[model samples]
Target: MLKAVSLGPGDLSLLTPAARWAVEEAEVVAGYKGYIELIPDEVLEGKIVVSTGMMGEVDRARQAVEHARAGRKTVMVCSGDAGIYAMAGLLMEVLESEGLLKTVPFEVVPGVAAFNAAAALLGAPLMHDFASISLSDLLTPWERIEQRLQAAASADFVIALYNPRSRKRSDHLREALGIIGRYRRPSTPVGMVRKAYRAGQFVEAVPLKAVDVDKVDMQTVLIVGNSATRLVEGRMLTPRGYHRKYAL
Candidate 1:
């Protein structure tokens, strides 16, 4: 059995029962070194661990698949929901390439995504329609990322940005905000959560124009609100329009 399990944003307590079960039942656990380290020593005890560093996803996926193919129970861990910017897609691709897509017993164990976790800390900023876009240009072209930012902004969709900034792409988040500014007002509420539900947690709601871009990093999740979103009592909220048809 091969399972792509999500470790949630952080905090071991947030790990889902299913994800924990997959890990406990697995003979081998593989994931990025950072995520692997999040697993409790008790859960990882007596298990074969295959941990890799940054940009080592392909190798980890291949090793997990090979272990599974060899009749071993294997789990590939991811930071958030496996299906969202995680190892599930890559594992599936590798399985298909190995002609084991149908023959292999595989599953994706879902957990809290960064956007969901961040939104919870920032109140209901996602009550209305929203779009999630990653600013990383490693696999996708910068032009394409910019196009998505433009489209999401012009459509008035609440935007959730992932991988907003990094050492190499220091200007990506600033550039993205610039594109969003073309359509959104400078006063739009923007929620920023760093290390959501984890240590060094930082949550703030600021106007779009006031965001301190320098403080944002890959660990941050930024939620830019729509025209109707507001900062109420220090919380970011996007109304669902319930007041339009029904009494509050």
Candidate 2:
């Protein structure tokens, strides 16, 4: 059997029970090296761990499927929920293409995604309607990302940005800021959380125009508030109809 387990951002405490169980029972585990490093030593003490660097998703998926086919319980790990910008879809596609979709029994174990973890650290910035967009154009076109950014900004939806920047993709975040600037005010609330729930975790909120794009990287999650959002007592918040409905 093959299990796709979500490691939940970077904290072992955030791992769901099902995910923990999958890891505990798996004979083989495969994941990006960074995520593999986050797993507790005891959980992986006797397990066959296959660690790969970035952009190794296809190879990792193939290895996991091969292990499962050999009658071993294999688990592929990912940070955050497996379904969101993670390995679940890629693994499924690989399995289907290899004619093992039905032959291999598999399951997906869910975990708290980065957006949700970052939101908790930044107060309630996502209390209202929101959209999550990835800035990385490696697998997606920059034009499509720009279109989505424009639509989300124009609609006044709170935006959660993933894969905001990288060494080779430095200019994308600046371009995204420009697209968002078209519809949002200069003083709009923006919160950035890096390495959430992990070592060297940092969370801060700054005005939209003052956001330090240079400080944001692939490990960070950025939240841009909607027009209705505000910073109260140093906390980013978007009221969820409580003022009108509850008279608070």
Model 1 TM-score?
Answer: 0.98
Candidate 1 deviation (Cα RMSD): 1.1
List the pairs of residues colliding in candidate 1.
Answer: none
lDDT (Cα, 0-100) at 200 in candidate 2:
93
- lDDT by residue for model 2 (1-248), tens: 99889989877789888998999999999999998988889999999999999978899999988898889999999999987999998888888988998999978888899999999999999989999999988889999999999999999999999999876869888999899999999989999999889889999988998999888878889999999889877679998854586654
The predictions' CA RMSDs to the true structure, in order, are 1.1, 1.3
Instruction: Tell me the TM-score of model 2.
Output: 0.97
Candidate 1 deviant stretches above 4 angstroms: none
Task: Output the lDDT of residue 100, model 2.
Answer: 90
- List, residue by residue over 76-185, the lDDT tens digit for candidate 1: 99997998988999999999999999888999999999999999999999998999999999889999999999999999999999999876869999999999999999
